[model samples]
Target: MSKAADNIRFVIIMAATLFVMSLGALRLMKLQLVDGSSYLQKSLSSNTAEQVINAPRGEIADSSGEYLVSNKAGFNAVIQKAFFPTDNREINRIILKVANVLEEENVSWEDALPISENAPFEFLPDRESDIARLRKNIGVQVYGTAEECIIAMTGLYETDPQLTDREKRIIAGVRYTMYLRDFSVSNRYTFAEDITMEAVVRLKELTYELDGVDIVQEAVREVKTGDVIPHLIGTVGAISAEEYDQLKGSGYALNDTLGKGGIEKAMESTLRGKKGVRTLEIQGGAVVNDEITEEAVPGNTIKLTVDSDYQRKVQTILENHIYWLNNQTSSKAKGTEANAGALVVLDARSGALLAGATAPTYDLKDYLENYSKVANGENSPLLNRVTSGLYRPGSTFKTVTATAALNEGIISPTDVVNCQKYYTYWEGWSPECTGYHGRLNVVGALRESCNIFFYEVGRVMGIDRITEYASKYGLGEEMGLETGRGVKTGYIASPDTFEARQQVWQAGNVIQAAIGQSDTYVTPLQMADQALMIGNRGVRYQTYMVDSVYTYNMEELVSKTEPTVAAVIEDKTGHTFDKVIEGMEEAAAFKAYTYPTVKEYYTDSYLLTELPKKAAIKTGTPQMTSKSDTGSAFIGFYPADDPDIAFSGFVEKGEYSKLMIRELIEAYYNKDYHIEKLGGRTEEELAAALSDNEDTDSFDEDNEDLED
Candidate 1:
């Protein structure tokens, strides 16, 4: 009975086993023949990624084809999300280790978290937007304190509780940066840029511990002629969150760098070349094959109108004259507070800026390293005074007065105006002149700079006619420069400007405005443009800084700037500007013969009894206040009979603006002046100099009480 049951059980068990085996074989055959290829394609696609290969940024050069800014190969530390650990604690550990390595090698990494590094954490000043972003990302209230946000970030990122506040802060910063960059398989986060080889080597040693970290080679901005024109060339830095949001649709990655200021920013579209793509195949958390699917295109090269050598000479002249003025002990020298100034030279016929120099300037590298110190330094070294500085034109405004008087037939060029040493035109306002010239015509008045003559003429023409002439000559107007923003459109001293300040425009204000006082303020660039218009007699041209743009290798031209007419002065009397030109010529002759200060400063070899070419020049000593020293200003055009170049200079609280005239003329006529070159001040030197220059005499351009 047991044998029969065992036999029956064996037969049933064999039959069941055979049926299960047949079903398993059929399923394996279907999977192997039909679904295998689909699953294999899915596995391959999941591991493959497309990476952006950034193109090299364009280079910048002066008009003479000398490189001002270029690019060099550098290494960057990157973190790939596909290979990173998913655990929060592991991510924190890896970031802290990488930060330690960077600190040891004296390398800087991107840590833009708004909280302070120490325990008594406070939000940094002027980082409202960043702080707001941090708060939102961490799910904190908008009004939450820095400490509260830090605590929230610490908890959210699962930072190590045993770590110090500083270590926790480091971890939080990297994690937040990752979040801001949208770090994922498609987008890699850049941990550090332009790192030293030492840092790269150290980071590589910890490759096993730092799972996601990798080294990448990229092109970094290399400043070649930073000292000559730092303010104009500007700088490049990491793209901000706001910038990323605006540029993301344009195929810009969060890790991309862009121009931060000046020409670099103005020409960003041309300088930032198109990006390329690289397709990578990953297997076992390692990149197995990488192929370039698209090739990167380098940016265009920009050619500026400025000649580097001439620019350097101009910078030296301004710096030297400013230095001399600051050290003067004579009572006649009122430049003890003259710590800053600007000088500009332009081609009178074309309005091409040949040279522009702003003193109390800084190096670009120093600015990139310690932006706060440079930005907030004494005298505002970051300020491009040539285009941004607003100063009283003083006697320089008389040019507009004479033009108005003659054009409107209020007074002829031969008509005489009495000078009583004071303009008693109004009862309470009696603005005095430098001396009592008794009576003088237009040419004589300009030669002697008689405030009384201009005051009488300005009162006759009224403020409307005066403003019309001033606008024609580009006074108190925009220069229409091709450079970046910050070009101020200063206003003329009229009822409109006074009304803008919510003040009454008194009748006597016209007398002051006639002499370049009251509310009239202008930049040195505008002054040069005025001189250029005077040289051209009636026509004014739009000024430009960029000359042309070319391909990356400069083999093909992209674009070129052409001279364009901006304005033409309308004259009822065709001989209006004739008298103004004669007056300026006589004024230059008067200075050459009577002014001994310029002759005393130059050696006999450099000095001359007469200029190489006749110049039409005028000087101004605009008073800031009764207590404050006056500002020195001068404008001129060379070869008065056949004007070639026009120039202007202004020194704060200086009384010797004429001293620069002779030297500038010499530089323009001779090529030797551009031979000598000098390097810019170092960061340490700049800091020490700024500290020593404490009496900056800050002047608020918008202050209502600032009267000349």
Candidate 2:
């Protein structure tokens, strides 16, 4: 009976084994016959090679549709992973042939390899880090020699068949560059950018032998404004390795271009478009199918608040004035040279920077070619004096003092103060004025920029009050231009600031501070904002040069940065800015008929009858350090009754006649001398057609410096 039970168990075990084997056979047959096409498709899809498609950078424009900076179609030579040879010796031979073809066609190819191609191989100093990174990638030590490093690279990349000395050198160089560029199987390499058409055609023809070589069409930054607004518009350059490393996660390629300075740098993220990707299914190095996995999003267009025409007019006028100031023999003054100057015009209500110009400037196109010349030249052209250049506000501060004094009840609008030409409130510390006006009210004091009147008022209000008003008007604060060195806020004379800078602020410092002298310094931009604030009756707007941002097609609105209030005067009544503006109106009243509110200002009256708009002005000739040389400053607003435009102009060492604040005002309202207000250009437009191309003949060019 035990033997019979054993036989039955064996039979059952055999039946179970047969059932399991049958199930395995059925599953194998299903995979091979029924689902075969799906598996095949999956297998082919896995062989795809990914490529990056760079998006065109955004075009920059003035508020109008005119473009200041744009992009043009550019040709570049690139390497394709699909066609690239796998053999090390073949790759070296192909790359050398590629280099030879480029050289023959007079086309430049960018090879960032650290080691020299010639014998006695040398490492480039500028590529030290790149070389070290490549070495570490190839298992080389930091102490290894350049040739040893090259030899080490050959073992990994140019292996299998032995490479000749020349072949080894060539392959090693390309390999090192590939490593530095963070090249991968998916990301091919960019050999050259902005190549000529002849080079492109030649490269395409040689693609069979060169293998992987392609001519890709791309966009290159083209400055539409030429040299006009070069400093403000800024420049774009090839991405550094450090930059690439920082942006790699964000899909940035090594050959990408980026803004290096000015507005370009400030608005990079807004201007740079999103990158796209292309995937190709390759079978035995042959691409059988291709697809766009992602679509590139074009960059948003940026519209600047600058009126190209008005800005050019102001720039030309300022330039011509400085040129005259430098050569004027009779008015040959001392102090800081007048080789540099700045002028800014803004919408009083909006704080829109309609125009801002800096002298000793260069065209945007010429920047690359003339970089060394401009950089090494005197009175730096790169320096945006509108915000970065600091100088004493001079007598312009009288308005601030007047505002504070009247607001704090230290002085009444009709109060009288004696300008005995000098004030001696402290013993052995008498501050003298340029003129000896006997007696003057608040209006007369501002009309003449009376130092004594402000000195006495400042004494009553104290330094703290003056500082409070200055801060309220956005003085000694960042202008928020974000245009690199063009937006730095200047220093204000204060006890805290003086202490921080390791200097002393004494009782007499308050007197000089009130007169826009002492340790106080203000930029032309700040002064312009001050003018706008005064014209707007204490409402200081957050000044901006850019107006709006749109898509490339102008069909979609990306962003619109409208004018917003930055600060406002605490005075609820018309006691502060209104009274100070009345004084300003008087200062601009060079003629009796135009603006009869204030007394006659001892300056030229050309703008009174000549321009379309009347102005309220204040003049300053502060001997920055000495009595002989003075910096010319003028703060004014147009149509004194209903202010439209506000202006601030400064010359390092200027005469009163060269201020030309009147001409700038007239140029804005009238189209006759409207140089900077013209529309910008298109992407395809040539540099010769740039706007702001006008003459300086219409305005009165005959004037010498005002006597201090």
Candidate 3:
């Protein structure tokens, strides 16, 4: 009985075992037949990466729709962190090989390391910040020398000793740059940008050996009219660590290009389009599937109020006049030291900047290629003199004083003041005038730029009244501009300005201030805005450069900048500005006989006689200090009876600021001088044309004579 029971149990166990084996066989068959491809894909796949597809930055155009800045297709050599070699030695080897290839092709790569490439290592003199960052990055002390830092970096990167010092330095530079960019599985590094197709093809040939390397096609910022408006249409550069830290939360990548100054920086958000995502599936070191997960939206186009061709013409005129001034041999020609200046034109009614020209300027493309030479060049070519340079308003401030005196009831149109060529108002202070006119009214005073007349008037109006009027005219106030920040708000000659400088404000200062001489400084833009206000009869519009913004393809209008009234000076007396306008007009129309020696240089005492339309103008010679030469300044508006445009110009150590007026007015009136429509051509065609014209210097012929 026991043997029979044991046999039954054994049979049951055998049956259960067979049933389990049959279930396993069925499961294996299902997996092989139904899910085989999916499993096989999972086994062979190396990575599934989500890459950022950079969007094209916006194009910038003038009000007439001429391209000022645009984008051209270019290639960049980049390295994906996920696919880059993991081993340190292998990484160094790949970098060394890539560097050699670039060197052989005479192409440059990004190398921010401050150390010298050769064995006699030394820290770059101008890269103080970079050296400090490098020292901090390598766990070296601030006191560590360049040699010590290089040795430490060599060991830190685990570079092979068999490599030459130069080879190691090259690899170190790339490694350090990658580290600074925070190279990780989530971020890629840009090795070099704006590379040639030949280099791209060469790189592609070594794709299998160059792990993680890629050639990305992108839109490079091209300055179509770089020479026309470089200061306003700014520059674009690689994203710095500081910029990245501030922008990372706003979808900015570790590797990104950003605006450095001017319009580019001001409209960064508007110009930086949303980046798209591309999901890449890699298998056996090759992409098996590629899909664009998100489509990129290109940046909007910014249209400025400036006319590019008019601006170019203005620049040429300014350059030519400056050159002529510096080359004059006559003793009567006094501005031999004239080396730099600025001129600004604005629509008198709207305050729209028509043109702004800064002398000693440089082309944007040349500035990028030869940064050191241009940056360190004489006369400060990079300085935006129109907005940043501060100079005493000189006699130009007399207009403000005259306005204050007239508006405050201190003076009248026919009120006469005797001029003995000296104002002995205070006990110890006596300011001299250019000539002794026996008796003159407000019109005669302005026409002659009579200092004694204004001094007496200013003494009666007082400093407080002068300051008030100056503020109303936008002097010592911020002129709202669409271009980027760093505009200077120069102060009026007042007790407050003296106090800020920790100097005592004497009672006699008001007389000097009345003539625009005491501690008063103003920008060319401010001067232009003031002229606009005067032209508009006390109404001041907010000065602006951008007219509107449009969609990437320029099919849709995003926003328009209207002519907004910023401030208004009400004439309580109804005809308060009548006499002031009369004075400016008289000044513009004044004529004086000249000696033969200087007649050719100064055709008329007032230089606006040849202008097609009547102009209300004022000229000033500001003496900054006892040691510095006087600077020439002029402010005016055309068609005195019906003002249209206002202009202000300043020339450092220059004589006649009015010399450029007639030519500028002619350029503006002649519609044929406007830049041709660049919208008809595609971006590629425009870029090609610009490239072909790169060697065509805009001011070369005009400046050749002034090169001494």
* Candidate that scores best on TM-score: 1
Candidate 2 vs candidate 3: which has greater lDDT? 3
Ranking by TM-score: 1, 3, 2
lDDT of 3 at 266: 91
Q: Count the backbone clashes (under 3 Å) in each candidate.
A: 0, 12, 0
Candidate 3 per-residue lDDT over residues 1-708, each given as its tens digit: 699999999999999999999999988988898887778877786878787888899999998898889989889889987678889999998888878888888789988788887878999888887788889989999989888987897899899888888988898899998887777655678898888778888999999999989898888778877787788888888788778889999988767788899999999999998888888887776667789999999999999999877887888777756665665544444577889999999998899999999988999988878888999989999999999999998888888998888787888778999999778766676777776676998888887888889889988889999999999999989899977487889898787789889999988888888888889989999999988888888999989999999999688999998898988998866666777777788877764433222333323422576676678988888886753578889888887877888999999887777767776777788956543333345767545432321122232332211100
Candidate 1 matches the true fold with a TM-score of 0.87
lDDT tens readout by residue for model 1, 222-326: 887778778878898878999988988988877778988888888999999988888888875567888999999999999998888788788888887776556
Per-residue alpha-carbon lDDT of candidate 2 for residues 31-88, written as tens digits (9 for 90 to 100): 9888988787766654777877778989888867788898898987888767787776
lDDT score of residue 547 within candidate 2: 85
Output the lDDT of residue 49, model 2: 78
For model 1, the superposed segments whose C-alpha errors exceed 4 Å read: 1-48, 282-288, 592-600, 603-609, 625-627, 674-708
lDDT of each: 0.81, 0.74, 0.81
* Overall local distance difference test of candidate 2: 0.74
In model 2, the worst 10-residue window by lDDT is 594-603
